[model samples]
Target: MKRIHDSLIVQTMSRLLIPLAQLFALYVLFFGQYGPGGGFVAGVIWTTSMILTFLVFGLKSPQGRLVEKVLHGDGVGLIIFVGVGGLCLIGGGEFLNYANLEIPGLDAPARRYMGILLGQIGVAVDVAVTGISIVLSLAYHDIEQEYHV
Candidate 1:
């Protein structure tokens, strides 16, 4: 419940760095289809940002707002994954059948690509949320246990 850094230089640098770090992580996550990065690497990057925020600014600091949102949206990740799967099912195929989805003004291949992108996003979110939760649990177990009761 305290800002861990003592120096103004560290704090100012952190404010500039964390958001940029998170943006780069998200770029990796979203652009995975065209290049090398994917959900796993992006999730790790995202988790690193959360852990770094917690370390530099402490859990109660305003700098951790993004991490707090990630914590609260854990279930949302699951819902997104399931909902995408359900979309495949509703599109007249088995669960997660990306090829069967139909989109207006697009061919089957385009729909397939869209489905793949959506699936990747869902997985990325789920993995990132899970990683963030695990980090928080391990790092702040004592605080959580003390407060949740």
Candidate 2:
């Protein structure tokens, strides 16, 4: 693997920008319901940040561990999506019928909003995990080829 200090300026800049990029990704995720940015864009940003980390720090770095965690979490989004649908079905409504969720403390609109937010979160997690998994596999393959050659 290449040294972290391959270029002083590049190292410093990437280190600084990575966190900011991740923060912006989160911002895009939360504001997606109201604006243009959403799960897909947020997932792209997440993939970009992970790839940048791998490029800068190499495969053996902490970023690799993070990628592994992401892989493990890959199915979480799907589970959430299905779980929500199941809950609706159990509530005697059609699949994904947010209106059927009855929380005594909150009104129908609030329940619907919560359901939408959960669905969006599931999508975001699914997309981000898939993107990260692809990038990690490619990175691993490249490294394996490099070492074998």
Best by TM-score: 2
Q: Per-residue lDDT for 1-149 in model 2, tens only?
A: 34334777887888899999999989998898799888778878977887787777665567655756677887898898778777878877889998776556877788787777777777878888888788767667666764565
Off by over 4 Å in 1: 1-3, 141-149
C-alpha lDDT of all candidate models, in order:
0.76, 0.77
Which candidate number has the best lDDT? 2
* Pairs of colliding residues, candidate 2: none
C-alpha RMSD by candidate, in order:
3.0, 2.6
Q: Any idea what lDDT model 1 has? A: 0.76
Q: After superposition, how far is residue 60 of candidate 2 from its true place, in Å?
A: 1.4
lDDT of 1 by residue, 29-79 (tens): 888989999877887787777777877776656666657677877867668
Candidate 2: C-alpha lDDT: 0.77
Window of ten residues with lowest summed lDDT in model 1: 140-149
Q: What is the C-alpha RMSD, rounded to one decimal, of candidate 1?
A: 3.0
